[model samples]
Target chain A: MVDIISQGINLPLPLLMLLLGGLTSLMVGLLSERIGVAKLREVWMIIVSAATLTSIYYLNQSVQKAGVLVISIWGQLPPLGGCFEIDTLSIFMSGSIAVLGFLVALYSISYMEKESRLTEFYTLMTFMMAGMTGVVMAGDMFTLFVFWELMGLSSYVLVAFLKSKWGPIEAGFKYLVMSATAGAFLILSMAIIYGMTGTLNFAAIADNLRGAAVSPWIIALFSTLVVGFGVKSAIVPLHTWLPDAHPEAPSPISALLSGIVIETGLYALARVLFLTFDPGMFKLPIAFLAVLTMTLANVMALLQTDIKRLLAYSSIAQVGYMLIGLAAGTTYGFMALFLHIFNHSMMKGMAFLASGSIVHETGTRDISSLRGIGKMMPVTSLSLFIALLGLGGVPGTNGFISKYHLFSAAFGSGLGWLGIMGVLNSALSMAYYIRIMQVLLGSPKEGFKANEAPILMLTVTMAMAAIIVILGIWPAPLINFATSASQSLVEGLSTYIGAVLG
Target chain B: MVPLEPFLVSVGLMFVIGLYSLMVKRDMVRILIGVEILFNSANLCFIALSTQVPGFVDPYAHSIVMMAIVLDGTVIAVGLAMVMNVYKHYKTIDIRKLRRLKW
Candidate 1:
């Protein structure tokens, strides 16, 4: 048994994490087809949950033990051969993906019970998990592209999963067209990189571009990648698809889209910009984008009537706050970005889950119709209150702590205006957050009786809400993790070049 | 020997045109075709870039182009399925007509 275990398991930690989870989900997904489709919900639930959880464990352990793990296939040469370099930045990202994926999958068990075709839903979600893992861990641009498409394809299917509704189908179509076009821009940019540097591996291109003089093509490359990734992350001017798709999809998947998917896309943008290009030239554009994204999203969110759509806009604004940290381009900037990513995932995930409970009970997500919902279901409303407090950056919530770090990074890096604008955006966000709380706590409308959400959903929602406060009060551990992850990214590029070309 | 520069320019134009259509075309089918055009342009760019290495074609570029085509095909197929659904539900594919959701 020992010999078998040692010999058969030489795969690197992060890729192995994605593969085991992905392959297991694919296998279970296929099996569920021949078996009674809806008969084995528990089986699908156990398999996916275990897969995501186990992968999160191994990836976390490996990053803790070894700072960065690079795995290449078939002894092929790099800057060309497909490769995976799992560092702290990628670990932090993949960990966030898997952690939220596990929680959402847990919530899905109770939430998706009334819906049919449960097997396929879990399968596609797992494939999406695998796709995201592949993207962040990719060592070369092409690998990232390949996995990006995988994630895109899976998400389109998910967005349209409620195919019986015209709204879902329409939202899915718009999302597909926009996302696919963005993908083309990414490929074009990659071709430009290859045309100049003749390598797809990130480290080699960084070294090549670093030694070269500034050129017009390089600038175009930056803009195209930004546009390509910005759409997925729901940056302003390209965020029109989010409100429609998020509101139309099932709630757990809404959590997945809002909580993890958009951020992963932003991670690619930050990774490419931070590691592969001149950070100085890109800083201003990113800062401009940050300011634009926050202000516009806040304004739109203030006028929203639907619940999920409101959360979707709020998600875009959070990305803006993270982008401010990115524009600062310091280790502290990166720290702020990562810390806020973790915190927002908790707060927003809980927010969507709680609202989903409301929608589930009431069958309507319109803000006007849901007045006084808190009077009927205290637990769910309490969860929503906690979520709102976190989003509003109340003193004792995780959102405030992360936003504090982000503002400090902005000011410390001489972008005091950006930090101040960020504070203003947070203040603007308060108007809508308070509106939601008011509606939840208002007088109970006659003829509306909503039972409490299922135990499984309530537990998941409460768990995320509690984690927000706990992390806010004692934020040292998550902040330390974010600090270490950012430190690795700032310091790891040269070490990355040495390892790749050694 | 063929001039790759003109070919690259043409393909670049093709991509820009497709992007324009994707942005402005209200008809769903036209947008899907625009996506196809962009994919073909990207494929052309990949093939053109491979000409730099003399005497042998770059296998990696070939494989990537092939994979992109397949993914592109999947996207188009999905888009078509969506169009069919739209036609069934609303009897037309004009983008403006499906305005129930506030954009």
Candidate 2:
């Protein structure tokens, strides 16, 4: 069984594909440059990301059959050395990453064709996806941190890729400073965990530390963990960089960052908090942060003039909503959480891509200046309208389906007030979504001219829009997958530990 | 056994110093240095905690610290590159001067 899984692949299949693809693409990039071949790197990226998706499908089959597949690095067993433990949850999360990456790679071909530095852009983007994949599949704290840094490093460069402008440079620096600080706190948290448990493995740490009585060390660990993960996730107080950074990055990257990258941070937070403490222990504090995150980000999002920045703030507010599921701390709640993660990735990712098409055509991100864009670019504007409605949780959209499940899960867990706050915030967020919609649908301003976006970008946005609508209507399959994913994390604890310890 | 109090106190002090510099420093390069200090403080905490075990030091913490230091160096390298770009654009490394992107 082991040999079958390991045949010609030492690491997890998705991670190996991504890492190898990222490395070889660097060479491909240089060769393309020397050979005067254009669009070669873009083609390589598209194949790599698509292959990553296929590998995840294969890995998912193995995970389902084995229940948990533990792959130790350097031939060292777990609880002592670094490893990757893939359960249903890892497959689900990495599947989301690869899906978004594949779509973004396709969209970037048309979107970034005019930009220079194609090599660095495609390579760093691939590494960034590879990093997120490793992070989700990581079995130990050190492995997670290493991949976390890899993700962080690649994103910092990608955020700053267009250095000809001051906006990206400044945003990238601020992002780097804050994220590097978070990385430091993550190390400190690891040290404290080691001090408490004498091992860095997730299963070992969970074995030793979960349900331990409240102590100063536990309190310190909790705060450090929050600080470490919160900045990247853009939890309210640590979120200043996001509004700037997300908008300043190139549009496709903006889509990826606001779409899945922040959710990856929230995913790490959920995984660690669940492993180290009982759900009852951290529920209230996380709940409180959820309220703060939602209220503040919604209010800020309402005030934004720039379309992408507004979407960035809305992303934070969505993170706030995801935290409600975490705070509820039920299997049902976790299912809701992961459900919302996938749904939001599609909705927000499409929203950004659609807006990116708008920006590419009109050369502006200001919402007012985009008046009558719907008239000029009917297909792009139509997709954007669908994306906006999905994000606002309108009925018959996937966002509403996941959000309905999320709020009910909160109420089911006796967090009725949180559910109420979530509903109110959902209502409040619609104001901005409608604002964008109105801008798109309004009569055209004089002298405004834009043709429909290129066929590739339009197809990607329309595909995501179709997904949002189709899943909204027939959500049973996705809901079932999310339920299994959450069950692995919340109820399959024993199986996960046994896979690691034995 | 070696006492852990002094090492813990030093780590705490370094942390505070690093955060203070991060908050107060105007120079972008100094801010990056502050981040490096914070990283080193965490590395020191790991090393110190690894020593608390009697009769033998855990090699795991040493290995992690080695990897972490390299990671920190790369992060700072990226930060310095960003700082250079900031200088080219704003003609100053003062972070406050790069405030064209306010809310």
Candidate 3:
């Protein structure tokens, strides 16, 4: 038999890592019945994370060294079986997803100690991880939709995993309905695109649609895609499910959802819009969403009493900031957007996990009741503090680097107003971060005693915080990778088209 | 000839009705049914659109619609499972009553 990958590339291993996660999930229920599922989950998650990281790293190296690798099953062409386009962008995203997944999985071992359904939790989470990897790497629209559903399905289950609680079940239902509606629009778009271009492959669709005349229906197609994807990404008007869904899930899962789920939606949107339509026509609408999503989410964040809810709103706002870069439609703007995606993932993951440790120890998520909890749980509080600074775009945190570039890139790309709005929003966001700190460290509340979280959780949070600071100061490497990715996207459909069709 | 207008018109009307019920329904079960209706409408679009192409049926659209149905079924199954859990906790699946996770 001939080798399957067209470009002599190795089998797309990141996808393998993801699929393995889903495959292994079937065994988790049975296995957990016999052994300590939590501990077993930790081991399994570590292995999955290692594979993910190794796969992503090798994928990145290959893209950087060789070229964009298109891997299809059984050597089938694009129109036949689904294809995976391993490029700088996909690998960059998978790298963050894998790394955060490892840390969150590690932290969840300790955090979810008292929670029931260990195997189910880990299984859904792994399935979710696999789904994300698939979405990022998917070269065909149908493949992306498949993985998108995989991601959405697992998240719905994970959100409601704590089924006994009324809050989780309620939130999970709302999330399911909203996301399912979004899924409907997604398929609706796919059906129309199939009807229009008579192809489903991303690159092939791009080639066909670009040559076709721009009709009114094309706008409808784009609008449906935006609405479908925007709901998943939680862009402004469609973002109601996010705050509820993010806060109701297990903290580690919340970290994953907040950190990467919405971001992946945006990623898919960018990829599809770039592949199929004339992107210049769409930049203004994207910029409009960017402004609206950021400003509203930040204002909401300032009003939250629950720490996790606060972070959740803040996550939506950060998506707004990332969109500013995306809307700029410049090479640097795109690079900055990807960079912030990675940076925000680390910062938000750390924040959610650190807060999880606090909630784990103190049995509360209210910032008011948890006065001086920072003193009680020193490491976690500190991590939360650093994560907050990163979130607020403090000078020495990783967030600063991305946000700074984002604003500059916006202005450079002639969206000076967007840059100004971003700065104002970042400034507006700082108020809540300060309030969190005051609650965490300002004064001691009587009769509230909580110790530090477990060693495992502590190690993970601190490691992420340290990374935030390090990346903040020395972001050269990430910036380099992001620029290359952006360069490829900005260069347009030629390279991507050639790779897929051959 | 499978006259395309009627199929498109019916699918469009059903989609609107499903979305309307989905938005307006207060009961969770009703909401789930609304979702199912929307999904079936989408499936109808898929199948109906396939008929427009000349000659034989489009296998890709058929396969895609089938996959979509399976995926849609999975979503509703989970939705129903969640509905069961909701009823277990609150003794009702009324969407208006479940006000726990707001804001």
Candidate 4:
């Protein structure tokens, strides 16, 4: 083990963090029930989260030493074997996921203690985190698909954690149906690509794509891939399952679902689109899809009464913004997309955590029932307000910076219509966000009383809120990171192709 | 004209049957069976593809298909567990009544 660690190809520290967390959580879960010790579960969760956060910090530092780290597991070569490749792009995502994951774990301590299946909940959460991290760091198609399924399966189980609740069970069922169909489409696409190119590694596919003639079959493969990932990313038409699934999930899991997991799907989409096919194949359809996704999601979000459902719709809308960035097929576009990925994770994670606190205290998730909650749960309400504003792309918030860059990238790419649609959606999202605030701050309704969330939850919310503000104001390092990560994606293609085919 | 071999015709027929059952089946248990049939059809297709590739059965695709079968088995097992839970909760196997998410 020591030799492996010392001689290891430069692995991103975040991946190790997630692996350790998942393993520890699984061990603790198995033992905690047998030993009849409850506190040990909490202790294990905290230790796992801390270790993940520390590893993320170390990963950020290592980014300076290595432009990007590409590591293979079990010394496996690509195309025929699975591998993990860490670049600046993946490291940035892993870091953001770790930060939010740590806070959510802390929040879950107070939020989930009263529940009977606490150990199971923590174990699934850790596994889900590890899966997401794996998806981002995956070096090849097979690895990405395997980790994608891991993330999807864990989330399906988590969505129905409240087994007795009809809402959660039905939501989980719908999610499973949609998710399984998507997984099948993904498998079919992979098989076709392998049949055509005789290799499963992404880099090999790209090389074959350049010299190989485009056939109708290739188009079918790409379309199938779009549908598969589109469902996970909650693109317009494919987004029906999300509004139900996100809200039905526990709030911490909702944070993960909305914040990191969906974005990981989009990240994979972008990586595949940019790496596997020429820019010409993607230009028209992706831009058109971006426009449709943005417009449709914002329109649907306007009608939602449930706060979590509204946010879920907004999550789809945000994915559209990232799609617009990626469709540009430029370094600036990749930068904008990744920047939004980080910012959205922080802002949405805070929002979901705050929503959890609200539900914890009020025992309801309806926007109307949450009326005057600002006066009762002042801290939670304030953090939520900040999150909403950030989500709406208000100035001095991280959302604003990322959205601004995305809009600029769209315009630079000459897709002014997409830029306009994105701006319009941002304005439209504000309407629902502000309405929720109004309800939260308004007069108390009959049978309503003041209550606050637990201190641990409050601390987690405040920490995320602060990071959102800080990153918004001082975004130079993040901007640099995003730019470099985008460069790595665009510049490393030839090397990747050569490495695989040679 | 392309020759329609009996084995190829049977594979196609099995695929259509499996797809039809998957779409028409109301019972969760039946749906799992349909999925199993689809898996077998796909396995048949894999064998066909391997034969077309000349010498040895393309070990790469063969291994991938094997892995996929294992994965499908696990997924079906989980689906069965979920079906058990549904039976305990709603006391029925029909999917039409599971309408908690409808707008």
Fnat of all models, as shown: 0.65, 0.92, 0.63, 0.10
TM-score of chain A of 2: 0.98
Q: A229-345 in candidate 1: lDDT tens per residue?
A: 988999898999998998899999999989988998988998888866666777888999999999999999999989889999999999999999899999999999999998898
Order the candidate numbers by TM-score, best to worst. Answer: 2, 3, 1, 4
| Candidate order by decreasing lDDT | 2, 3, 1, 4
- Of candidates 4 and 3, the better by lDDT: 3
Q: Candidate 4, after superposition: displacement of residue A366 in Å?
A: 1.3
The sequence of per-residue lDDT tens digits that candidate 3 reaches over residues A158-203 is 9888887888898899899999998888888888898787778888
Indicate the residue-level lDDT of A395 in model 2: 97
TM-score of chain A of each: 0.95, 0.98, 0.96, 0.94
Clashing pairs in 3: none
Candidate 3 error regions (>4 Å): A1-11, A25-29, A35-38, A211-214, B1-3
- Please identify which of the two predictions, 1 or 2, would achieve the higher TM-score against the true structure: 2
Candidate 1's displacement at residue B70, Å, is 1.6
Candidate with the larger TM-score of 1 and 3: 3
The backbone clash count of each candidate, in order, is: 0, 0, 0, 0
CAPRI class assigned to model 1: medium
RMSD of each: 3.0, 1.4, 2.3, 3.3
Query: Which of the two candidates, 3 or 4, achieves a greater TM-score against the reference?
Result: 3
Best by DockQ: 2
